[model samples]
Target: MTMRAVRLVPALIILLVALTCASLMIGSVSLSWIDLIKGFIRQDQTAALIIYDIRLPRTLLALSVGFVLGLSGAALQGLLRNPLADPALFGAPQAAALGAVLVLYTGTVEALSFALPVAALGGALLSVLLVLAVAGRVAGVTTLILAGLAVASLAAALTSIVINLSANPFAVTEIVFWLLGSFEDRSFRHVAMAAPFMVIGSLLLLRAGEPLRALTLGEETAESLGLSLVRERILIVLGVACALGGAVSVSGAIGFVGLVAPHLVRDAVKGDPKAVLLPAALVGAALTLSADMLARLVPAPTELKVGALTALMGVPFFLAIIARRRGAIAADAS
Candidate 1:
């Protein structure tokens, strides 16, 4: 690693740790450092239950999901060679949510069942493939974005239809929660279910860094450098599908971390897709944890969905990206 990166990484780790502690502290009950230290050292049951049973899982899920999303986004932007590319932008998580909805409609399948994540993975894979297909063999950034929007809308519509047709009100509620995406009420069981996917998927995306870096120079040059386009595509798609599907299965469809996280670290990595994954993951973890914290702190009878908050904040960034894309397209045309 470069000296700059080595220096940056420790700082990022410290930031993530600080944000995690903040997440642990800023909840409905408002925990103190003393409570946490006592919880750990003296085994205080009340503090332990709040930290261990409640906040910890949500915090961990935020971190894991954020890391996976960040890794996937950076890898995807590399694959598509588009600054705006992300799993959420491409509707991958919506598809995964659809898969979960199909399995758990009316809570028909247990939320903890293996079938939930498997179906979500299948859905995510299908969505990504369709996006690729719709974008065509040589699609522009605008075309890819439009295609993803269409696919996402369609998937969301189907998901709503499933919810509307449900005879069970509980099932409708479950499906709606999955659609909105939040970390509330998750448990260690969720952490366990999603951990394997996060680990494996992170590895797959991290491994693709070399090929992704090579591809930045275009396919022909990458191929000449012994990069297999097919292999790279498979790793990107499957890595995203597994990690994102698992995450959505547990936490619904938290969007925009993939969009926001990688971009935050792009300059730090000197625009190297290969080097951006770790930094992006760290930033993503911090972002998600912070957002989840806000979701809790929002003063309403019920907290806001983290997904909605991200959408609200990220729309401006999305529009800026579109403006940039339009300028690039205009320049190309000229």
Candidate 2:
């Protein structure tokens, strides 16, 4: 690593630590640093309840979810050779959300807390399989992207239909909440529920890192370097789906962090794919944690959706990237 990159590591670590403490301390009811420290040590009951019950789990969930999304986005972007590619671009999140909605709208989720995550996993896996199947043999990046778009459109249409057909007001409200995304009232149980899948997914993506780096020069070049394109593609797709599915299942469709975080880190790190992953994950954690903090604090007692905040920030940034890319292409053409 360059000296500049090495310098960034310490800065990133400090930033992450600061963000974690801020997340723990700045909530609807503020807690002083001493109280926060005391809560962890069981020195104060009020501090204990607030820290243990509310802030800790929420912070952990945000970290875990952000890590998964950032890693997933980095992997997918690397695999597809498209900076704009996201886990959702492949229909994973939409399909997973649909699965959770199906269970909730049918009133089956209440009976089984694990049902929604399981259903979401199934939906995500199915979407990946469908995209691969449609792409068929000798599938190139363009074909895969087209196939993903088709699957995403289909999953979205199906989700809309389910929401529209649901009769229960409660179910509709629940579905809407899930779509908007929030970390409010999420407990350790939710953390425990999603951890395994996210961990597995992270491992899979990390394992593929070298192969993905080889792929940067193109499939033929990667193949010349003895990288199995097929296996790598499958691994990346499954890894992203597993990680992102668990996240969407738990937090409900928190968008843009996946797309934005990786890009920011890639630029900061000068496009070193391996170096980009962890920094992107840290940035993702920081972004989501800050957004969740804002979601709770904004509008006083009322909370804004975490996903809405991300989208609000992400859309303009996304547009700017698109515009710049277009301008670059035009210049090149000229």
List the RMSD of every prediction in angstroms: 1.6, 2.9
Best by TM-score: 1
For model 2, how does the per-residue alpha-carbon lDDT over 218-315 read when each residue is reduced to its tens digit? Answer: 77899999998888888877787778767888898887788898988786778877677777777788888888988878875467889899889888
Worst 10 residues of 1 by lDDT: 325-334
Q: Highest lDDT: which candidate?
A: 1
TM-score of each model, paired residue for residue:
0.96, 0.90
Residue 112 CA error for candidate 1 (Å)? 1.0
Worst 10 residues of 2 by lDDT: 325-334
TM-score of decoy 1: 0.96
- Checking candidate 2 for backbone clashes, the offending pairs are none
CA lDDT for candidate 1:
0.84
